[model samples]
Target: MSLVSTLIIADDHPLFRSALRTVVAQLLPGVQIVEADSPDALNLAVQEHPRADLILLDLRMPGVQGFSALITLRGQYPAIPVVVVSAVEEPAVMRRALDFGACGFIPKSAGLDTIGEALRSVLEGGVWLPPGVTENAAAEEQEERELAQRISSLTPQQFRVLMMLADGRLNKQIGGDLNVSEATIKAHVTAILRKLGLYRRTQAAVLAQRLLRAESASLAELGSAAEGGAEEEAE
Candidate 1:
């Protein structure tokens, strides 16, 4: 296959973006690099450059709710390769990223060489991950994977409705935001619940909350690791 030409780095941190840009320049010389600090910007970038070779997405960026943006990006642009680059290094989080359709997951703490290898592997149409991670699923992880599959089955519009529901938006409010009728929003809600095998809207909200908690925990762990690493370097 051809080499990657245009790459998008979607992260809110300027330092991280700069670091990644340096690595990309070193590994993939002469490639065009785009920067997006939020999900909205990322969407716009994709719309403007539909043929971008790769997108490195951060999970905790603004204008995105946990993995919702990743799911939406995969749904909308299945042709583009997206590799999640984040500080969250939890195996469960990594598994969820792959389940949500990321081609690779690169921890922020990884060395530049590892990041380069990941980008090269992804460009060569191979999935990349840290050592010791496997596709094998535990029983509970399998259930979560099934749930993620169901969630991935949602249409883009239905996914938006589900996200609004998780945000506690009323049908009328959601309809106003989507410029559709309350009846239409209600229909989407019904479909979302049915597809997710959920009984009540509250259950969907609870599921969303669980995902948020996992992301938050991962971020917390990442912060602690960063701090510990800095202390170790100082000593």
Candidate 2:
């Protein structure tokens, strides 16, 4: 039998998923393309799509598992390669996805050729990153250096609070958004700033943004919650 690129595409957007279907149809031809409208659907489909060569996952889907389903699935199916296909193009997320076992990261902005090329590279057992990764090597090193210097002592909640600060949400707003009291947000921010040895919130915000972005792609791979949340709030 001819090799078929059996794929399971999981995303919350009907339009995006449909577009993906079209792309697969046009490019892979005889390949088998399965669809899952949400993270839960993807979880169910994973069992069905056994021997599936590829799983194109959307980052920031929803729920806690949203951060880690890929790693879990990979552990279960070591032979299958999972490609993080997301609109989140932040460099932080890109590196995290790779760190969490994603074979490739295909930003939504990528063209058909780019997507196809990545798919081919993954199938060939190579890490499929854009040329810019090497092109941006110097900046990449600088970022890692800065991160190592800055985030060496933050607690988990302090880290999360710092990221909300980066998102430009105030203590009250962050508290409300995260379901914590403003006092707690304040405390966390104080802790984060102290740990990072930063004098201003702006510095902390910038650093947090970098850290969040770095965690972006892999954030999706971290669990199944994000995808589940995507389903619950599907538009």
Candidate 3:
């Protein structure tokens, strides 16, 4: 089995970016790397690419564009952690990047071993800071998990409606598919949004997929374990 995680590398310096890719490949073979030349390409990749598990960033990528890119990308896809790998090692600059949602910061001069360790750590639900950073990525993850739990309390009807939303089914279509009235589906959707702390149905839909997929994975693991146990007992 392979870990299906994605990585986007956005930097203006081609040589450095290529080196970074090699480093990542050597470290995290499970990660699929995508390269973006300009900030625009990076931004587009962030939106168009589905399932970006991590991002390796170069902060000094011409015009100081990477910082703003990091901010916008984090704002849109907070689940994807960005690791800043830049030559700038100023304490203030490092702290600012972490403040703006960078999960880790590694100086460009850092050795291959350190970079690999940094990316690996962040992918495994941990954050890396060279020395000092005010914000903690683990705390944010805990908060997100707490919010997910609160949202998971949706009523059965709301949960079903959210599942439909995850399937990209519209309200009326979901109602028809589930043999419920459209108005009732609408009510359920509203309840789901309220519980998920989302103002948009699309946001609720994304959250629905995350939760459902996690549940599916757990069930799969249990089934596999049971089969394995049965096989051993028969020996």
User: Cα lDDT of model 2 overall?
Assistant: 0.65
Give the whole-model CA lDDT for all candidates, comma-separated: 0.79, 0.65, 0.65
Off by over 4 Å in 1: 213-235
User: Which ten contiguous residues of candidate 3 have the minimum total lDDT?
Assistant: 218-227
Query: Per-residue alpha-carbon lDDT of model 2 for 138-183, expressed as tens digits?
Result: 4535444344434534554565566567678888888898899888
Cα displacement (Å) at residue 207, model 3: 33
Model 3: runs farther than 4 Å from truth? 1-4, 63-66, 131-235
> What TM value does model 3 have?
0.53
TM-score of each: 0.87, 0.56, 0.53
Q: Model 3, range 1-235, lDDT digits (tens) per residue?
A: 2254678998888888888899888877757789987777887888877578878887766644324455556656777878888887765456556655678888887888888777777877777877554443344244443453444355555655666686788878998988988887777776655555556666565555654431122111111121122212110
Per-residue alpha-carbon lDDT of candidate 1 for residues 1-235, written as tens digits (9 for 90 to 100) = 4587899999999999999999999988999999999878898999988999999999888756678778889999988989998877888888878887899999999998999888888888999988788754466467677777777888899888877776888889999999999888888877776677665676665666655543643221111121122212110
Q: Ten consecutive residues with minimal summed lDDT in candidate 1?
A: 226-235
Q: Provide backbone clash counts, one per model.
A: 0, 29, 0
RMSD (CA, Å), each prediction = 11.3, 11.2, 15.0
Off by over 4 Å in 2: 64-66, 135-235
Winning candidate number (lDDT)? 1
